[model samples]
Target: MPTQILKEQLAISIRMLERANHIDFNGHMSTRVPETDFILINSAAVSRSTITADDVIMIDLEGNVIEGNGRPPNELPLHTQIYKRRKDVQSIAHTHPRWSTMFTIANIPLRPVVMQGAVLGEIPVFPKSQSISQQEIAEDLAEKLAGHHIILLKAHGAVVTGTTIEEAFVRSVFLEENAYRQYMASQLEYAHSLEDEDIQKTKNVVWQPNNIRKIWDYHFSKL
Candidate 1:
């Protein structure tokens, strides 16, 4: 198979993870393989800062091994379910960014008032349940993710997906930043929260999955 496209995508995925500083012993990045039900995901336990294109592992929809030497993420089903449910999606990013994690612990719905927050809008909280497993998390996210690109999982972390790695990466970074700001704003005597109308307008203007593709392509071209 022609690997030029795959290689480029992998490099972009790695760079996105690195730039966001999302690396840890557990955090990971993954992208869908073109024209197939496979995903190229970073191997488990790899440092996000040092991840190279060759460090990516290709896995089937069922989390079955395909190629590459290292272990695929235990959350493989998370990416696969999204690909199965949303054909338009080309990539998925899962991270443990600090601020987003704060919201996860606080059990709050992140509101959008600032431009970046507006770009993200509202993020729903996922309640943990015995029935909720990794395989079913994507479907749960899809239900609540109708107009949002980011979600805060209760006690888990933040999950964001996009048509390209860059889009996903940007959303992830902004989501965490917004969460941090919101927390700080709450403590101040007076902080401006977004009005309902403004939030709705942003949701209307930039929340579509297709818009993510357009934005990323423009950025990718520039880079």
Candidate 2:
């Protein structure tokens, strides 16, 4: 029953991300199997919008499929490396959202442009434009992602990590939203970021369990 629920949550997260345009055909999401070295992720061929629990596969840290028949994503190392590095991170969302990707190639730093962005603080850029297909590259990316919730891959995309699937999914959405707003604001004048005090105060209220649940529930309902 627990595994079934996890699969459902994975499916819902994929659908929500696709609907929000955080990902299309190229992105992926995964969750570490509780108390296990396995991860459940969407299969390579599965489109985010049409993915079901059956489309999800279980794989080991080495990117070897442990269960399910579908092939894992080529960027499987990205998920495995983060899980190996951050034990507290239970879920991950690796996407190529337009605005976030734009910021990466535009050489603009993603800062706290609004209350939602405050929860994320300063986002880091991975400084690499290539796909993270090698173990070494994945490790380097993970190192850059250390102590950060979101990291932008130069000309690639962004990766969001959280202690829960909902948190990771919500962070992915907000990352894109923040980037979109910042991009728009840049057109008018130099956009200012929230001060540290404002970020801390807003994060205290916005990142609470109840608030995360509210956003998670609302997005899941759309799936």
Highest TM-score: which candidate? Answer: 2
User: For residues 162-189, could you state the per-residue lDDT of candidate 2 as single tens digits?
Assistant: 9989999889878888888888898999
- Residue 153, model 2: lDDT of 93
Output the TM-score of candidate 2.
0.96
**In candidate 1, residue 8 scores what lDDT?**
59
TM-scores for all predictions: 0.78, 0.96
lDDT per model, in order? 0.68, 0.89
lDDT of 1 by residue, 86-185 (tens): 7777777777677777766776667664666877756777676222336666677667656566666677676787777667776876686677788888
lDDT of 1: 0.68
Alpha-carbon shift of residue 127 in model 2 (angstroms): 1.3
**Candidate 2 lDDT (Cα, whole model)?**
0.89
Clashes of each: 0, 0
